[model samples]
Target: MKRIFTFGVLAVALASTVVLLAGCGGGGEEETAAIGAVKVPFWHAMGGPLGDALDELVLEFNATHPEIEVESISMGRYQALSQKIMAAVAAGEPPVLAQAYEAWTGELIENGSAEPLQGFFDGPDGLSEEDLADFVPGMLDNNTWDGVVYSFPFNKSVRALYLNKNLFEAEGLTRAPATWREYEDMARRLTKDTDGDGEIDQWGTAGQISAWMFENLLIQNGGQILTDDGKHAAFARSEGVEALEFMVRLLTKYGKVTSGYEYQNDFQAGKVGMIEGSTVSLSFMEGKYTFDMAVAPLPAGKQKGCFVAGTNVVIFAEAKQQEKEAAWKFIKWFTSPDVTARWAAKTGYVPVRMSAIESEAMAARLDEVEGLREVLAQLEFASYEPRSAAWYAGRKHLEEGAVEGALRQILTPKEALQGSAEAVEAEFLGVVPM
Candidate 1:
């Protein structure tokens, strides 16, 4: 689940209105017991079945915890959620809890709009060490900043290769490719003009120009996005160039470029042999495709690497103490082993807690969905993207400037990536004073 937006616009809008945070301060706690339960407003971007799954959990929480009433507000999409969050924060009236990507969390933290969760983590009702250890390490790391916890992972997902079993069978590919070389070979074999019309009716694979996919390839090829101090770009090296080149090769020779979830749609329609997308994509495809489909871990590049996507939930500092406590309770309940397992089963998002993978819900789901076990296994080696707010705009530059430029044959891989790197460096410099 990748989110698209131009952070430069949000940052510029925020800079002019950030001083409002100092003027309109946090509200005092009201005696809610005298009247009713404390209200916690949660803003999110989950839509369709994902929204349904989230709403079910919210209803369950509200019914089970009589002292708290959570209002789940859907912003419809990520771009709107990001814009609204910025507008609300600027006006000093942000929601009590909200879904935020790492970049948004970083911006909120820098502006003193996000609450540090370490105090809650060590509070009387805090999670024990055992509970903390149960979560995937990468998930925890994604929500942490400056050695402190600022948010908790929610709806986290890893990229997966969805295979059209019929296509693979026809091509005599018994198993999913385990390496990039094998993948290319399989792609070459799977692409075909089935009707003898001299036009490729069935493509080997299809995808959009995605920075997330590029990041996965970059890391698999042993490249890091930023240098050690998180201050400079390091992805314009040979590893990145090689990654971009591979994407261009596939698109040009064996696959096709698509927009949004068109690749997933094409795969479901049996027009594509394979497609690279998030694990959550399964939820969208369920009951829609007629072909025998299977999910696989992404084809490895030199070594295995996967990037975790999706957003985390954060409690705003402007909320009342009671509302903050209520929000924390909801966060804890939502991420519990059984709850997370059920969420995974319902939404096709990977469970954040390791124990959830072994839960009965996940086991039942694995039985229903082919190759889900392999997809979930990717968490062991998965990593996250850069947490700096600058990466938001920087990622757009990668997709539009580097990935698209190289794919469109407008620039060589090295030239495209180097230009994106310079632009990202400038963004980092621009946000230093903020």
Candidate 2:
């Protein structure tokens, strides 16, 4: 889940830095059209093919729009982008637009650094009711806070279970598991010591200690990360314990524990039979391996649940009015049905709009990709993590303290979760004035 971003230190750093730009103005906005092409600088952490796809879209946008030019600046990784954004905001010179995680958007909103986008959405050149209805509700909801739209979902992805189909066929398994029970049974059966060296080389499944994965399992078991009031932690309860215990059983009894992207490498190398990964991972594994693969919705627990992942596009309040206008125009254009569909088709990301999912571009992609249709179908039940800035640190605590502690046998699941809950509660108290 800590793909290209690590937030533990950056989250704390951003809290102190973002507030420094409060009440800062973007200066006068008189007759700026005479200055030629209002430049809107966009800071992002998209590299590799993802970055290439985004740059292509930006080029297309610039080529068609003579009056507005968007400068897409690559920050290489989210951690560096986050640090640079905080430093820029503190210096009163933030970019016009940036890709922001939910927690970062929350921090920016709290400090008055983010421009509330609802106004633009309701403006003269705004989206129509039909245009608004095109977006996937959950994806749109992720960008709205306190009943106000503050950003727009960008490069969104959902967790999907990736299965090594060749291995499945070897075991005479016809399809992916439909339930946690079936998943566990298949994991047990798929694990093997092919060389007979008394050491198992092939695992049924593998995963890193991930708060993202844990969040999906928690929701599947009817648990929430925070209380309904959104003021305290709720993951120490029975539901959470059950979720962690299941993960522990999978790693210790049936699978192996990994760190960072080792699980992904293992899965690709055919050393692991299955893995829970982002839909975007398909782009990374497309033609690298010889084995047949399949992607499916995460196996159900007590109920169906999937947590949406990735950042959103937010415009800064400190940018000039003209720059902000240009940023909005680009955001609007980029998220349109056809544009989003094209982005998803080229990058393996899920389109934020339902119309985009049904568009010809995505339909062609689905026909070409093996398991993408099922992956996109997960959007129907997808939800997002807490938008509270406290969760930026809270998730790190969950992964390192609760998840790792339990997986390493250093603490019982209950004890590990209780510790994480107490830590997150402390963060909420520190970040928000109770």
Taken over the whole model, the C-alpha lDDT of each candidate is 0.88, 0.87
Cα-based lDDT at residue 147, candidate 2: 87
Give every collision pair in model 1. none
Candidate whose lDDT is highest: 1
Model 2, range 1-434, lDDT digits (tens) per residue?
A: 58436676688688767765442322222223235788888899999889888888887887778788777788999899999998999899999999999888888888799999999989976898998888887777778877899999898999989999999999999999988899899999999999999999999999888888888999988888888887788988999999999988987788988878888999999998899888888888778777988888888889989888899999999999989989999999999999999999888888988998889989898887667787788788888877776788788899999999999889999999999998988888757731
Error of 1 at 98 (Å): 0.4
Tens digits of per-residue lDDT for model 1, 166-274 = 9999888988888999888999998999999899999998998888889999998889888878778898989999999998888768998877778778889999988
Task: Name model 1 segments beyond 4 Å from true.
Answer: 1-35
Model 1 compared with the native: what TM-score? 0.90
lDDT of 2: 0.87
Number of clashes recorded per candidate: 0, 0
